[model samples]
Target: MRAAIPARIKLEITLSYLATGSSYRTLQRLFRVSRPAISKFVPEICDAIYETVKEYIKTYLMKPYSRVSLTKEQKVFNYRLYRARRIVENAFGILASRFRIFEKPMACLPETVDKIIKACCALHNWMRITSSNNYTPSGSLNEEDIDSGHIRQGSWRDEINKTLPSIGTVGSNHSSNLAREKKDRICRYFNGEGAVPWQE
Candidate 1:
């Protein structure tokens, strides 16, 4: 639909789908590409991004955030990097699930896929700012759950405290009714509703 846009821009659109796990059907029409082409693109891009970002993440960011170091600066840096990864990965997972595209082969694109990955990260930062609050553990469930599915209860608040966005939300400037509705859907997920707006 938005032709005349630079190829770089199209890449970003494609990356958004990958990071958020959006379906080919959602992107095929938008990109004017066949489903098979999209299927081919995502995986090719995944390696490229990991190659480009992994070094930056491990050295400048992750190394500094280490808590095991005796130096206070090192500890502080390590902690920060640790928290940042959590925030970033959580957002990626959110995108993947919301878009429903995290399966094999689909995540293989190249520059286009990288663009979508960045866009998903950017969108996560955006929503972090706009949400009414950083997600709170409202129910009896543990507030902090590792990917292993182990839920922690005692220091949940402490875990939240160590989180990157605990002090402030990320996006406070965007205004779109569609975005709001999408957020509502996400909130429902957080609430453990297990229902989709499309069903309603």
Candidate 2:
């Protein structure tokens, strides 16, 4: 009987596949594993990693109101919200640029895809925390001009945009009362105590 592949090698293989989106054949050449074995184990490894680290991945679901006319407070709120959204986009842009896997859609089952994404997110967070200097060097991410308050696009944006399509804005007319209340509170805070000097 053949000896089993070690757990560490399996993990390395899975991570390599996720990071590069390389084909099994390519990975087989690189890792010396059979393509069929790689295909069978990659998804399982992703699922395991995702399950272990999914709790570290938190998502906030909030959308700014899509309207033309707005009050000053609402405008301030929107501006702040937009800035926050930009930060998030930049983060994903960095992730996509670093991990070529996200440059294109994964050709896999939806569940497997979800696992892959979760696993990648966990790994991204880990790298950011442990090796922030190497992971995100100066000027690699969007920067705000102190004097002009203008955003300087990051290099990651150029690389990511080459492969990914621009995201479209989705307008919605419906919002729950609780969500509205929360948005109002946040708006009030931004316009009031939380207001930044440059936001004026």
Candidate 3:
């Protein structure tokens, strides 16, 4: 029987695939592993990586209200929320730019895709913490001019925009009473004590 592939080699193959979005055939040639073996082990490694790093993942779900609304306070609230959302989007853009896998949709099961996303996010966080200097060099992320409040597009935007299409939200239009109340309270805070001079 053929010798089993080393664990380290399998990890390197998985990371290479994630970072480049390479095809199985391409990876087989690059890693000298059979296509079938690469396909089988990639998902397994992703699941392992996600299991190891899932604790670092946190998500906040806040959907902005429609633009048709009036109220000055509501408009400000939306603006602030939009600004915060842009930061999250920029983070994704950075990841997509560096790890080309996200630039295109993965042809995997939903659960596998979920594992891949969590694994990539975990890797991104790890790199940011351990190698911030090289991982996120200057001009690689969106920046706002402190004086003018104008957003300066990051270098990642140019690459991500070329391939990543915008996707619309998929959910009901109606908000629950509790959700509405929470949103109102947050809005009040933003307009009141949490207000920043630059947010005007």
lDDT at 186 for candidate 1?
Answer: 44
Q: Model 1 over residues 56-122: C-alpha lDDT tens digits? A: 3322222222134444333433444454566555544444433434334444436655554554444
lDDT of 2 by residue, 1-200 (tens): 98998889999999898878787889999999998888788888988887776766777556686778988889888888988898888889888887788877777778878778888888777787779889888888899887788989888777764858665655764788988888988989998899888777
Query: What is the C-alpha local distance difference test score of each model?
Result: 0.47, 0.83, 0.84
RMSD of each: 18.0, 2.6, 2.2
Q: Which candidate is the best by TM-score?
A: 3
Which 10-residue window of candidate 2 scores lowest in summed lDDT? 161-170
- What would you estimate as the lDDT of candidate 2? 0.83
Model 2, position 126, has a per-residue lDDT of 74
Error of 1 at 123 (Å): 2.3
User: Where is model 1 poorest over a 10-residue stretch in terms of lDDT?
Assistant: 58-67
| Candidate 3 per-residue lDDT over residues 1-200, each given as its tens digit | 99999999999999998999988899999989999898888889998897887776676567676768657778788988998898887888878887888877788778778778888998887787778779888998889987788989888777764857767665866778888888889989988998888677
Better of 1 and 3 by lDDT: 3
- Against the hidden reference, what TM-scores do the models get? 0.35, 0.85, 0.87
